[model samples]
Target: MDDSTVDRLAAELYQVSQTGKPVAHLTKRYPDITIDDAYAIQLAGRKLREADGRKGVGAKIGLTSVVMQQLFNVYEPDYGYIMDDMVVMENEPVKMSEHFVPRVEAEIAFLLKKPLEGPGISVADVLRATEGIMPCLEIIDTRYEAGTMKVEDSIADIASIGKVVLGGALTSAKEIDLRYTGLVFEKNGEIISTAAGAAVLGHPAASVAWLANKLASYGVSLRKGDLIISGSLIAACSVEAGDAVRATFDRLGSVSARFK
Candidate 1:
């Protein structure tokens, strides 16, 4: 897509975000939209938000799991920026009124202590740069109406990420094996799903490594202090007002979020 077209689409997304009214799927309207066009539109939207005062803290990776890949019909993972405004304190109530269609997923978050610049970044490099790992809940909110939202539509809508809730104590990756880490997802005090860290591209750190290399192609690097949520360990569950969600990770503690 052209610059003007990208800007127009970004503006539409911005408007929808403010009004909580989703628009039609982008891929449906723009059948020829490519991954590059989608990222360009996402970047344009990020610029618009930054101009309005939101700061980019880090990025979120999605679709690293085979289930998520099949659900989205995308063969590879996608990444999106995490704005400072998108963070909610652990145990805080997420304002459901502010989101269009929110769903929650469990993930392992990586807080980088050193910059990772890469064309060939590996999981070992990611582990070495890690500051700590925290159990997290990623709220997925898509600005497009349900149906036929391909990877293109998702990437354009910031990988459908809404908000993040971080909890648990920070622990070094060297102290534990992420691939063997287990997670239990609870909704309203009932267990809804369970998964192991290996569910995410055989290991969560591998997902972060993938993001670093992916960003390197665009001349971007994962900088020190940046937080990256390695893709979801379990499938995302829909959330509504009065709902309570928590994710308990073995060796990583737990994080919770309430919808109100």
Candidate 2:
């Protein structure tokens, strides 16, 4: 709620991230914390990461689907900045030891070629920005005790973002009907879920549009070359050492990660 309190919580999160130890839920202790205060804590965490030499790549959207929203008891999506250091090479094995507790989700990533800012940004505007989309896997590692986080706690914890793995060839946004694009999510060589891009807020582009408009309210804009990860098409799956996860898209090829 206050600047000092926000910084303290952010520092606690930053410390846990480094030590791979989760802290207690923030909201359970600070019940009166507003969404604005949560975002302020997120911003403070961003500044702390930047100070540590991590550059902001773009942002990731979460809870984009009505199902996820209802599960979280929220009507809108939440977001967090994506840092360059959060990306892992497509062929690399993710070291689980570096994270507190991570779960993976499949997503479509939008690579913007033009700036998009708004209070009224639309899916059409997002597509017209002219770039492409790629298959991606987002690793959401919450820095809080398991099953103890509330929506505000998640917001302050950088929306539970951990690392990201991107693969697949980039395809022009105009060339594909994202709503019809489908994905087969797999874990340890078995199919886990099957979903379409429509699972992410009707169309993946719509998620990006929502992100752009939401960012505008915080005095942020989607810049050229920013890679926006639309929310997951499938539910988050817990991953452990020796496990493998992959998402194969209908036209976007596939991306995989092995945990070790």
Model 1: runs farther than 4 Å from truth?
A: none
Candidate 2: clashing residue pairs, number: 0
| Weakest ten-residue segment in model 1 by summed lDDT | 65-74
Task: Write model 1 residue lDDT over 1-260, tens digit each, in one string.
Answer: 89999999999998896787899989999999999999999999999999999999999999997877888777889999999999999857899988888999999999999999988999999999999999999999988887777999999999998999999589888988999999999999999999999999999999999999999999999999999999999888999999999899998999999999
What does candidate 2's lDDT look like per residue over 1-260, in tens digits? 77999999999998996687788898888989988999999999999999999899989999998988888899999999999999999989999888878899999998999999998999999999958889999999888887767789889988989999999589887878999998999999999999999999999999999988998898989999898999999989999999999899988999999999
Return the clash pairs for model 1, or none.
none
Question: What lDDT would each prediction earn against the true structure?
Answer: 0.93, 0.91
TM-score per candidate, chains pooled? 0.97, 0.97
- Candidate 1's displacement at residue 86, Å, is 0.2
Clashes (candidate 1): 0
